[model samples]
Target: MCNTFPAVSQVDTGASQHRIESAAALGTLVSSTASYLTVLLSSPAHASASESLSRHHAQVLWDLADIDARTAGLLARILQPFLSIGILLMIIRIVLSWYPQIPGDKLPWSVVVKPTEPVLGPTRRVIQPVGGVDISPIIWVALLSFINEILLGPQGILNLLQRKIDIS
Candidate 1:
């Protein structure tokens, strides 16, 4: 049955070969440590045994504290919102794209032709072409990429790891 599929057989054999030794070593260490602690704690000399157990417990707690610190630092680095500005810009652009323009009501040719005063009060008459370019999306994506790759990329993970190790 095992030999029927060569790929499966090979993978099974390889996995067993590679992992079995490590698994056995880990199991042995765990069992031995547990047995030792149990024996140490269950000894008749309660004071000495309690002190030893407390010391071992404290060491374990310290190790766990270090691990937590390192993990938190790594997560902080990885989860930093580098693309937030770009994302916000993109959202604004999307909203603007959906904006409804004011409808122009039809009027007499004379009224339409005549240059009316700007309704919103005094304004400079800059002869800009109607429906110019909208490059907000492009700018947003470019900025997002820049921030993600430059400001937050190299330093994030490395700095996180360094800080974690340093604190530990």
Candidate 2:
């Protein structure tokens, strides 16, 4: 029993000594790395190089921003006209709906009906015809108009972006 107790204490002491040595080595390594970093950061040449890199980085960011603004503005200009045309076409479709005599299969009537039907068909499924009249065209008109007003309107996204770009 006495021999067993001394063996256990020896093992415990050895393990504790190993742990302390490992902790001291780790601390020394960490402090050395921290001092190296501190020295590199404090050097005047390193500071100037970092400053120059920062200036270049800022210029690159500004250039990228300018390019993005130009591209977005161009897309906005193209999309605004497309939205307006969509509103115009939807309005024409609504007016044509009033005339029952116009044969839908014929060339002139087909032109309007063909383009508008794809959009109206899905809309009809969601919003059924009311009192024997397909109100899909009206719905599309209101939707298109609303979209046009929201996206390309006076205080719209494109306009706001253009203004911001211009001001900057």
Candidate 3:
């Protein structure tokens, strides 16, 4: 008996092609809209009065410029909340370090110290106390601050990634 079906079926090829074309069209539309909005919103008069707004809009334009930049921007946005939490926890830990007798089960205060021990323990071991003061919390705050800068600051990894994406 001879085989009737071909190795590669042509079924749905037109549909797939149409889907691909639609996706390309949608992408182009989105990019064009972003560029238009950037130009419309980035007038010097508006930007000069609101530096934060200007920076935010500029970053959005940068992210929309390429896939890698967009991914980096998205990652940075997702990580921002966690970074805020980390900073808050570090601040609490620093306060806790000032008091040696606050029990972990202490009401109201436990909320601050308990959540931060896991983060502080390793640093405490590595950093050691400075002049009889536990400096681990401060160290962690500094480290987390540094990490926040690397990942999300204006001249951060995302910006570097955007530059690389543009270069390529």
Pitting candidate 2 against candidate 3, the one with the higher lDDT is 3
lDDT of 3 by residue, 1-168 (tens): 111111111111332121112334336545654554566567666535466445545544432433355556566778899888989888887777787787867878778777888877887788788899988878878988999998788888766765563332
Candidates in order: C-alpha RMSD to true structure:
21.6, 25.4, 18.4
lDDT of 1 at 11: 23
Q: After TM-score superposition, what is the CA distance of residue 117 in candidate 3 from its true location, in Å?
A: 0.6
Which candidate comes out best when scored by TM-score? 2
Cα lDDT computed for each candidate against the true fold: 0.42, 0.59, 0.61
**Tens digits of per-residue lDDT for model 1, 82-139:** 3664455454443443443522233432232122223111221333223663444444
Clashing pairs in 3: none
Which residue pairs does candidate 2 place in steric collision?
none
Candidate 2 residue-wise lDDT, 1-168, digit = tens: 112122122222233221112333334434543454466567777547676445544533332333334444675788878777777777777787778788877987787788778998899899987986778888887887787676567886655545663432
Top lDDT hit: 3
- Using TM-score as the measure, name the better of candidate 1 and candidate 2: 2
